[model samples]
Target: MDPEGSRIQDDPYIQVMMAGSTLRKVKSRSWKKNRYFRLLEDGLTIWYKSRWAGRGHSTFSVTDLEAVREGHQSEVLLSIAEEFPAELCFTLVFHGRQGNLDLVAESPDEAQAWIQGVRKLIHKTQTMDEKERLDQWVLDWFHKADKNKDGKMNFKEVKKLLKMMNVEMNEDHALHLFTMADKSESGSLEIEQFVFFYKMLTQRDEVWKVFQDYSEDGEKLMLEELESFLSVEQHEGEQSTQHAQELIECYEPSETAKKQGAMSLDGFQMYLCSQEGSIFKPEHQDLYQDMSQPLSHYFISSSHNTYLLEDQLRGQSSLEAYIQALKRGCRCVEVDCWDGYDEDPVVYHGHTLTSKILFKDVISTLKEYAFRASEFPVILSIENHCSVEQQKVMAQYLRQILGDMLQTTLLDGQVPQQLPSPQELKGKILLKAKKIGGLEEYLDETCTDEVSDEEEMANCDAEMASTEDSPEKKSKAKSKMSRELSDLVVYCKSVHFGGFEHARSHAKCYEISSFSESKAKKLAKEAGTDFVQYNTRQLSRTYPSGLRTDSSNYNPQDMWSMGCQIVALNFQTAGLEMDLNDGLFRQNGCCGYVIKPDFMRDGNTQFSPDKPEEREGYKPLRLSIQVISGQQLPKVNQKEGSIVDPLVRVEIHGVPQDQAKDETSHINNNGFNPVWNETLDFTIHTPELALVRFVVEDYDKASRNDFIGQYTLPFTCIQPGYRHIHLLSKDGTAIPPSSLFVNISISELT
Candidate 1:
């Protein structure tokens, strides 16, 4: 995993004996010799004068390497080349960013081997990420622990291995593994055997029992037994059988690579850890949960300060922000409206130097793209700071641009007992600005979401003090809003939570409130049950506080675990937190809404986020996926404008943090149907909690690989088939039809 380390293990093709430092050289200009040379997957190292100490040494990463080949005339290799023999002379030149090193082998074949080997190492070394490092790290551990050098670890080694991995196990269980992993009864466990032991060592006994119960003969389950277990006992669909067959055949190795369907206990263990079957039953997704639960009962994908694309201080605000957010299945979009020239309102960060976009343009863009990506209702969380004239113009723009799609009245006007569902509000946009009722005259677009009394004044002071404004600008800051704009506030009336007891005051369908993450987490801790009960019927939002001004996100699952819907994130940012957000909503058809778990639903039966593992009916999964090949991969953004040395990375993310696994394919020189034919296997104990993402990147030798495209799907939504994964941008937003075609097999292990 070290980018500059020389002693690496994975590639055994180019063998190197421990030679003295007298054979190595660094940056050969005229001549620099008397050094030891060691080459790893990552780089080549030159140590001065036959020593492992750092007194005089230089490491060159593969990314820093320019080339490695036979010596050229007039090069410093002429001097060092004489040390070995005529055939052993090979020179390595470094890129502008790194130092150079030269190596001498014993024979011509060894020299060619080092040349080709170092080039291959560059690709593998530069492409390595945490997952790849883990893979290598495990291999490295296996090698180090094989003290007897029989390619297997003994019973004594097992205890040592467990300690090294930081595992805690009882004596009886350790003995059980000693026998089970010793499959051949050969008195020792090889790499695969140890891997099975590793998987078993980390898994839950209850989960293993569940998986074993699916075995018809109680000894082992092959493809037929698994299909029978799923389709008959589990009542899975007919395709489940196909998935089982495909997975078992893919996982069970055959001499001809055909369908053998032979599965040992270890094979079965790996299957349960994959995505073929979900740990949670389909019920967790509530696919059939009636949309009648009211909009507030579901989790809505929301955005915070949607106008700013970058940082809050100096970013440019554009209408594309709304389009991008909406296209990525964001249900709620925020807009900060300020008075612009000529009776128009503009959207921008209020207290920052961000550029502005016209409010009318944002409205029109929303009207066009609102329901294109997701059919669920769009909640416009407007932080209004416009004049009465501009507020009137804003209202006119909403009505004119949105037409009938804008919701301006209660559903049926009947004072219903429950709020309307997302289904009921389909094709409609709801205004979620503050609704100050009982006012003689409606204020202009000047009410905020929930910046607080003191915070609101501070934001205004910062906004105004940042720049000089005319008298009209000051007047507009305190202008009265038109009543027409206020009328648009139907279901999503942004209110502030007073207390856990008073949060119920907004229990009515239209009086929606919001809480920052700190406030919401506090409420959840102090009144866990009350927090749960409050969200049953009322609509509320939880947003990241201003402290997250850099646009990073808090783990939304923590908020989601408490059943708070409308968890707003800074949609423009990308990372694991965002990946989880995309994963959670990636279910239920990416419709911007997901039915709450029954425990979070009104009149809960028995569901608690803290005890997710104990949640009944949840099952483990075995997923076998073949990353076949990519078709027409878009070139990674580069000035080179080349076809691309493409590679595929398949990742599994979710709960059971340690169970997350990711693998990458070898670099394919072809973009058109580049046949990787690599199988990625995983056993997921928490399928409902896991997400699978495929990232295709263009490989580079001298720098980080440029991202080609990615596509993420909730493990539950993935169906077994020869499917085409239409890729998305790095941000999880849909791109063009450029895709990777792959075969998928999914089976429910328990």
Candidate 2:
């Protein structure tokens, strides 16, 4: 079961990849050069080099790759398809915001070999368990330290390895351990010996102490003793005996220990680091939330300016951005459509330097990937800046590309009293756009020519956004709308929001409103209860302010607190805001729709984000987290001889009253095995609405602290016990073996 063992011994594709091939790396139409690309011996990295850059090789791990798409799937690859055959080209799609690498092989066979080989490697990486990942991580470091390619290391190399792993060990102690590991009287230690030495050097004394507290003997724990540990430390309660038995049978490495109903230290550690031992509840990892509720009752995962890859201004607009957003479980994607060349429509940020993407191409991409991550309905939030003619073209593209997946008519052939549930609208694309009149009137008329003040204001505001004119002045301007495009609006009709009071009396359940971040925050603060009540009846979207030209995102939790169904954030931006959004939607199978808390969904219920104490059944929680230790943390600066002084911070984002953070003291000169053993506590007034974020940063006395890694999950998902918090990179990809060991306990505030 070794991660790097003889698993791929018979795989011909992998063998060919290891042999290497010269491929034409295509960056653009004209920039194509031959490069020698090969998979590293470890089978986890791809190394490539050009003759132009002598002795300078670059490598990327298989873990960094998101997918391997065959043929001309990328824009760069598509540009060169006229010269290169489809079978001879492939794309390496990297995770996060990394640009995709398009490559063309010498022959079709070489292309297929790389594609299949990379696919196999990706599958292996994805399917690896936590323990396997840890072993592979250790092996990777071993490969790095064995610089001479001898598969053996001497005391000198071992000492250097210690420093590389962020451990500044005493020379005497290091040599003593090295000698102890070299049992064969050999001057150099092999891989096995190196692993033994690593175990000795990085022993978890804290875990051993906890094991000693429960075990009658230092070596093993009997069934009853194991049950006691589960109940007392893990809070397993009545299920402790069963859970203990399961852990022993599953994680016990020794057959003798399993037969004797005894758990060894290895078994205990394995159980502690397994998925069952994770900080988040394993039961909540799937679609466990109620999805049958009306669409307005759920906080739908959404994206603002989905066409842009970077900042709104001067950012390249691409169809890949739409695909990425959809694949990340973003149900609602905003497309700012403007007039394009050749009587077609384009999507881009209006009045900015952002590049344009074909509206048809975006639709095709949406059709292909809309339900790939989540089967919930996708909302195409159209910010139309197109002329009436191009708008018609846009509508035609939507129908042609999306086909039956597009919901062009009302459900059950009638307008609903309330919006349909996500379950009912699954696998469908609903257009959120302006229409000529009400749903009934639009349904009856073939082409109604009307000048609606709401549609006029929306169109004018979008076109004249750069102007310093007020809302009143923006409303005075008018624009024409094509009936063909207007007919596509079914459930989600875009309308101008006049105030909470006006909405209470005039807004229909089928009608929706979009608010800028500033206005939404104002509404949430000035009239929280009304905002929540309004959302319970009608869908409301809160987007980033226009001033965020750099495509920064606002705190989505603030809008979410007021039960805004679509709190859109710039999906292209990566920060605390996107982290919070990902954390909230990470649960319920990441289906992009999370059911709002009970009070927030009930129109009659008077609940405000500012006054969680006044809500019915409000039970405050006392959360205690002991920041025990960190393991194999990444260096902030990946340079030789650099080490991080890491610190842990736990933040709770929710209602203003529940929002808080606490941090442990910094552990200097240690990124690996830095032990804090400090407890941080918080009182969450609204536990269901709260998100807990665990952040590791490199502490600095001078300047700002450098971010190491972070993990954020819903507060309700926090499991009470000794758990391992696996850290993720800023882009939300797993950084295996880099984790925090913590003890979490949550109880009702008495």
Candidate 3:
């Protein structure tokens, strides 16, 4: 052993090497037991044995020692206690053989010197590129200094470093240094850290006091105290949330409306006004008042009376039930009509045995019930369930009774001449052609009659053809001809069919026309008729079309554009009951409904209730909706003669309100306005409701607006899930349903 090695004994952890088998003996207070260490081949290999066990316990290869000494071995065993006294017993071994090696000292000055040493050594090793070597050097120094391995330099380490430099620091000053040095958590301080900390110390009185009062003997702060302080702050935030919820639940009436049921309209208005961050203005109050008006002009009287016309004959159809339904606010009604024995029109769904009740009877009944000219212009869709002759007779009777009130091509003054025989009519409803020869002949005769006699004769000879011939030839010729004839008389009206292409080749042609299920909707839109008769199957196929062709298959807007009123035929009471029970009536685009009386009596099915006296309403549901604009606003000073443009309106029904009256609850808040040209967001406030309905209308001519769509917003006051909702409109209403929900969860930490 070298003589100078004996002085290491005083350090209490020195090992003495021995010759013969290359063994060592260690003596120290920390190592109580005798420890053997061996050096073989002139210190080329070293080994140690536990003297108590008399066995070789650990060994060290000199080759590795040489490598580490040469800076080739990446691992650098660091004594953590030198920097962090709290981690005195721990030692961190860094992998230095992989790349650059770093040694972290207690002070920032020492750390800078250590980093410089690492940079110089790495540049000499050629183990990494210039950029990579710099990065490795910085990372290694940070890792050595991060005693807690939290990737941050804390106060204790900084204070210890200052003490070594003969500079004292109080806890606060140490903490400030820790904060400034560890801006990004990595323990080692950068060039900016020293400058920032020094500047802060010079500028702040607190920092200077902390530096002057620094003491190593001062008591260490307990970890529990730090954690408790953080917890208290977080708890206060949670309490605030609970308090807000309580406030909403225990809301009190404002002082302005304390005397009026505690919830007067004025109070509601105030509440709406108090809502800041909203776009609604006070001027929109009228819009809300207007929204309270009835969404539809017609109401079904005796909504629960399924047997209103069970025993009435086809001609003696009574409007007593219809009137009651209207009083209840049904805008549309179903009236069955049949032909009498003498070709008179009668109102009944089934065949009539007597002709006592003429179509005039029903007309008069309607006139009495209607009362005012514009109060409630109800649409009475007549379902033709009897023969074609019966329907034609009924139509004719209706024309005579209704006169101008009846909306038809004839009423519009579009007739070319006198009505044609029923048998000669084709497409849509069966009617007699007043002037035919189709388009070709009509055009020729009407336009050529003014020509000179010579020109007229020349054209007549070339155009003249046989009028009477074999039945097959006549039928074929008739099929090809597209003009009106001079002598043909009215016979039977033709029934329109959706599959007319197929029916023309198979089914016998009739004088009366019935609508085909396939084309009924398209034809109705084009004709602008208020009443359309369709087979039950077609009517039952209430799949939406046009609006969302990608899914709904039907667009209410398209239907509204077509002037035809929709009616379902062959509907049994059971089917109607099913529809009502399933909330089918709530679908948009449906104007009126029809069902055979016999179906109503089969099982005593009743109409669902409309008011509180009725059964519970269906669950609230949402509809996926899309809105479309039908017309553009007129420019300034534009012509006023044209019909006024319609404004979109929405009315919700079946919501539980404070009042028990059968009045509508208008959502007049700016949140419901469609003119904003942006989405209006709001919540529906109601409790345990039976049914939810949406009615849309225009403000100018309220009665003339169409029911573009309807939907039910499902009723679940407090829940976590998705619910679809649709917008409602009477005429040209285009807003789609807005989806809403509440999230009750903590924000995620990045």
Q: What lDDT tens digits, residue by residue, belong to model 2 across residues 1-750?
A: 263546773589999999999999988898999999998888898999996787899999999998999998987888788899899999899988788888999998889999999999899988987667767887898899987989999878887788788876678998999999999979889988888888887789888989999998799999999999999998888988888899998888899999999999888888887888889889888999887889999999999989999997899998889888998999999888888999988888767788887888889889989999999999999887678889889989988889899998877887788999999999999999877777867557654554565556653322234243245325334667788888888888877777778878877898888788787887777888898899899998888877788999889999999889898998989889999999999999999998988988898979988988998898888999999999989888878788899999999999999889999999878888999999999999999899999999999999999999999999988889899998999888788778899999998888
Between candidates 2 and 3, name the one with more favorable TM-score. 2
Estimated TM-score for each candidate? 0.51, 0.97, 0.25
Cand. 2 TM to true fold: 0.97
Residue by residue across 16-45, what tens digits does model 1's lDDT show? 422322354535455544555555322333
Q: Which regions of candidate 2 fall more than 4 Å away from where they truly are?
A: 1-4, 446-477
RMSD after CA superposition, every candidate: 18.5, 2.1, 36.1
On lDDT, the candidate that comes out on top is: 2
Q: By TM-score, how accurate is candidate 1? A: 0.51
Model 3, residue 365: displacement in angstroms? 1.6
lDDT of 1 at 562: 70
Candidate 3: worst-modelled 10 consecutive residues by lDDT: 293-302
Candidates in order have lDDT scores of: 0.64, 0.86, 0.29
Best candidate, TM-score: 2
C-alpha-based local distance difference test score of model 2: 0.86
Measured with C-alpha atoms, the lDDT of residue 17 in candidate 2 is: 92
